[model samples]
Target: MMILDQFYAENFGKVYRSCGNCGTQFKRIVQINDLWAVNGDVVAGINTNFGDTATIRTTQVDGVDDICVKYTGNSNGAEPVEIGSGPDTKNCLYSTSDIKQL
Candidate 1:
């Protein structure tokens, strides 16, 4: 696994990586000021995943804006669909079958 900080210096940037075993293409976006819980501390964690396509959105809550991630994929028409969506503070997981929006 690769640390998010290694790929992005700030949030709101695109990251590209390919699976070594399957050569599956993956893309990720990092949003700034993303909140994450690691080791009981709510610090900014690098949010990322692997997939074929992705979309990102930003919302304002209580006068503060936040970013969200959404991804979808079906690798070569395989079984199991992956979808993930979540705030910038959390990490997401994806599989080859489908996109997982966290």
Candidate 2:
């Protein structure tokens, strides 16, 4: 699974907004395409959306929309969560707005 360090390096100036149980600030990030992290809980990709639990609505961070975002959620965890994944993991749409470009 793609760790936070690599994700951060590739997608600089981005922060996970949801403060889950860990609340480690920038320590954890959820890769929606894989569902590796959920509601702040870090887990391996189960190939399931877990029932569309999370959703990131529209919000502004430093007044920006287009930021460091990858086109697809393949290997790199830089893709915008909004772009979503396949049917198997489509429901689990985490808030892309929470991931802001600093």
Candidate 3:
């Protein structure tokens, strides 16, 4: 008799984003092809249509795992940011940082 088995792994990361317009914090999930290197050896990337903000921070999920993206931002005025999965579609996730007034 013979048997077959399969295994899988769950990969996740964190992508940080700060609003250049209102200092709002945002985050999104990093896809497989939406990844880039930043600051030499630091994995960085951004979700273009993440939200109303223009710029954002992207980082690896873990020190080893290079999947998913986590966002960290202020919590004062910080609120959930919209991450667009497609045209006219988006998901909401709260920032992991506190907001500061400038």
**Over the stretch 11-70, how does candidate 1's per-residue lDDT look in tens digits?**
333232222133354443433222221122111222234432222222112211222334
Which candidate has the highest TM-score of all?
Answer: 1
> Which regions of candidate 1 fall more than 4 Å away from where they truly are?
6-13, 16-68, 77-84, 88-102
Residue 23 local lDDT, model 1 = 35
The models' CA-based lDDT, in order, is 0.29, 0.29, 0.28
Say which prediction, candidate 1 or candidate 2, comes out ahead on TM-score.
1
Cα deviation of 99 in candidate 2 (Å)? 12
lDDT of 3 by residue, 13-78 (tens): 333333323454454342222223322211222344443222112222223322212233344555
Candidate 2, TM-score vs. the true structure? 0.20
Judged by whole-model lDDT over C-alpha atoms, candidate 2 comes out at: 0.29
- Give the distance in Å from residue 86's predicted Cα in candidate 3 to where it truly belongs: 28
Instruction: Tell me the alpha-carbon RMSD of every candidate.
Output: 12.5, 13.0, 16.0
